[model samples]
Target: MAFRLARNRALIAPAKSALGAIPRTALFYSTSSKPASSGQPQASEAETHFGFQTVKESLKAGKVAEVFSSVASSYDVMNDAMSFGIHRLWKDHFVRSLNPGRKSGGSPMAILDVAGGTGDIAFRMLDHADKINGDRETTVICADINADMLKEGEKRAQQQGYISTNRISFRVENAETLDSIPDNSVDLYTISFGIRNVTRIPMALKAAHRVLKPGGVFACLEFSKVSPAPLDAIYQQYSFSIIPLMGQLIAGDRDSYQYLVESIKKFPTQQEFAVMIKEAGFMNVGKGYEELTFGVASIWKGVKPLDSK
Candidate 1:
């Protein structure tokens, strides 16, 4: 099935001119959730941009929730198609960087995997945490804004039976704000492929910084700009064209897939994103790229200082 998808992707390359316009269908998809009233404090208008031509700031959570709702059942398949199976490797790298128990002397590690749809990162983290801590417990709260995604993740986790109901928990929460979790509690906070969909990324960074314990780590994995002229061009073609068609063929949801492509283009580059992390009060911010200069994705690491004021 994967081989067939790859061949089909190769045959349907997009033209350079086609990339200039965002699809109207994607930008105007009807959302089931309404934005909170404007009376509530809102992120500054100047800080916003279209996730896919939809006004992005106040409505970002609802719009993003809609996108995931439309594609939740097929989300994993779309991920494999879009990344050509490289997302697994990228996630593995993110986990290995944590070195889960090397310096902690087998103490239990608590992780907050924000926007961890379908438990992909959470499951892996649990496995590695066990290896590192032996009998010590590992707690992961997989939080996401979309309930459908969270339900799906919960179902998958139950099926694996690797996580007892107590060890891994799911919460419906926004990435931009996590009001329920206590400050200075989480040892590591990680969000994979979900930060770009956030309404206020800076606020999300601040929330992450606030949640982590002193000396805790924050890591993110998301789509990034590709490098070197030729591969970059090819990647652009593949993302904007073949990916949406795959969605239509496999998931029956082309518009959501198109939004996925547009959102990636709208995301900050690695350096700019690192700067955002620094602005959130994290220290020693660093970024690592994968898949050669293609820059298909990146893992960013930052530390919340033990002495942060």
Candidate 2:
């Protein structure tokens, strides 16, 4: 009986020894196979359009900043030369369309104009709200990614007497995140000829939706595809040929203007952009876009739902 018991003990000893030989971590954790790679480029290293050229998505913002900085001082002059002063009329119409300001016995609107660093749209919005709506309490926050552009806006604001009125302010803000802006704080969001320069249009639209109050409006004025092939051809010729030359002559920055024209061409069409706005969780009216000047430009608006969280 003793010999048999000793034999059993010997067998148990080997089993215990084997168990003790195993690593503690191995005993507690199992090895896992590596996840299968999607075989696509990483998002940070993704490619995005910079005018006619494709560039790293991470670098597009820097490139756009350079372009805007180069043209900051002469931006309005170049706009006048390129559009033959018709841009002024377009802007007037755009501001009038929104009809910004205070309602009777209602709170004044809080406006955010993204990428409007030159103060053109900001001034128009404030003017419309002040002069037309008689809303002295309304205020505008003009944001742009470029500091030089914002300086130009501040200069214009000072010149226009808006600085003293305290109705308009400027900030250096990227359209994609707008980190300085609080969520659900804005009553009206406007981006005029600016969204295309954004590295990610969808992200900008989402940010816009995030910042706007429930029932707040999102309005965009942008260059778009022209109707009628003959007219389009004429417009295309002028855009490609004369615009860059005008940029060189007026702004002394040919590359920047060339890039601007290319960026405009790269922008999504009116219908496509409207779909993007709707995808950002905004409610649209009709097709959600209005073509201006034979579709040379377009106006798009969307409203955040009152029931939205």
Candidate 3:
């Protein structure tokens, strides 16, 4: 069945009718049972965890790079298969919550979707804005560290008729240092399911802060801590025992999926991450995040103070 971007910004899979969409997963392999820290290597240690295995912090980026490069082509298909298209719903809500696409003062709105290698979020933002304004003045910069992923994103953009329209662009950029993006230029900075993989979460958050204009918003959607003892227990069983199996069946890449699961475990909890956002100089830190899907994933938001610039 083919999937199309629905008017609600959800990815609706081809079905007999509009009402047949239902999400469906299981995996096993994470070694840690508790929620994680920001996952940056401490100053005293030069090593970091790579899916329950320790590796030199300097080498983690390359390893993560290899994983994405291997899966870039199959990324979209696997995402649908694994999540049963539920991720599309999460993404839709993420963009809608921001709704930062309306034209302000007859100028094109700037959105920097960090680590948006495949352009899903960027495309949604463009569609959201244009549907409202009926203009092509909304542009998105889809940035990632992996060229292979960016290439795939560009191909998809072309498929969606985004080529030569100036509605979308791709860039190879590091999250911790957006050297090419000038300070206070971007209106919205978004990172979905990407921040946990960074070598330094604080540095990345700082960089996000630097690039956004005062009053610009920072948004992230990533796996988060789940609650209620019974549900957490079931989720652990499914993620650890079934997700790796799904990875092997869908992409023939079990290890990469295992790493992804482990990274989720190692990511900071919602409250902890909210604090980090505040530390990076964002305001409304207390009300910055919303839990989605009962915390299997979450949306975190913070804004630069309008008085800062």
Candidate 4:
């Protein structure tokens, strides 16, 4: 009986040794076939569009930042060349739509222009309010995520005499989360030709809703689909071929231009995007969006409800 018990102990020792040899981490992940990778566990990287490429969601923002940084100096020039200055007319209409400060309670209306690179929309808002309403009190905060783009905007603002009056200010702020902006403080929120580039469109929409005061307005002007077959064919060709060529010639950055062109195609249609705005708790439901220039671009507006929770 002693000899038999000793023999069983010898066998158990080898089994215990083998169990000790297994990695501690392996024991935790024993149910899975593969081990958990080293370093920060890969983030649950849900994919988002970066033009035509299906990139890891984590990498899209960096790529977009690179594109904007590279093209910041040349962006305005390319816009003029690609659209033949027709973009100006669109922007003029956009500013006119808001009639900003014209009807706001006789106080300095606070305008938050998100992703407003180079202050194009903000400048328009300030200029119109100054000229039309003689509203020296109105102020604009031109917010952009890209520093290089914002720097360029500040330089332009200096040249245009907007800096001295203090009517316009610049902040480097992300669209997905306007971290520094307080709740229900902004009087008007405008994003023009910029919404499609956002990594999370819904988050940006929510941010817009969050920042606006009760009865404040939210407006977005963005590229849209051309529904007519013949027009779409022409538009597609121009965007895919001509726009990239212009980028190469003007900005010396063909890849960035190509990405921007492709991004325009991936954006939602006017009506679909309007529904998204409503989902973010904006009022006017289905009645706030308008298509322009044969659906090449669109304007969407929503007012925060006065009695919102």
Which candidate number has the best lDDT?
2
Which has the higher TM-score value, candidate number 3 or candidate number 4? Answer: 4
Q: Give the per-residue lDDT of model 4 (tens digit) for 113-140.
A: 8888888998899888888877776777
What's the true lDDT of residue 4 in model 2?
A: 10
Ranking under lDDT, best-scoring first?
Answer: 2, 4, 3, 1
Off-target runs (Cα >4 Å) in candidate 2 are: 1-44
How would you encode candidate 1's per-residue C-alpha lDDT over 1-309 as one tens digit per residue? 121111101111101111011111100111233333334444555435554585636656666778899999999988887777877776766676665532343345667888888999988887776775453356677888788888788778879784454667777777766776667777778899999988878989999998787777888878888776776788889888899999999999988888889999999988888888888998644342233225677777788887964
- Looking at model 4, residue 192 earns an lDDT score of 90
lDDT of 3 at 154: 81
Q: What is the Å distance of residue 273 in model 1 from its true position?
A: 0.5
The per-prediction tally of clashing pairs is 0, 0, 12, 0
In order, what lDDT does every prediction score?
0.70, 0.77, 0.74, 0.75
What shift in Å separates residue 209 of candidate 4 from its native position after superposition? 0.5
State TM-scores per candidate.
0.82, 0.85, 0.83, 0.85
Clashes of 2: 0
State the weakest 10-residue window (summed lDDT) of model 3: 19-28
The residue-by-residue lDDT of candidate 3 on 1-309, one tens digit each, is 122332323221110111111110111111121122336556675777776778777667778888888888888887887677888888988887677454444445677888898888988888888786564665677778887888888888888898767667777788888766778777778999999988778989999999887777788988898776777778778788888888898888888888888998888899999999999988743466777766878888787887775
Return whichever of 1 and 4 wins on TM-score: 4
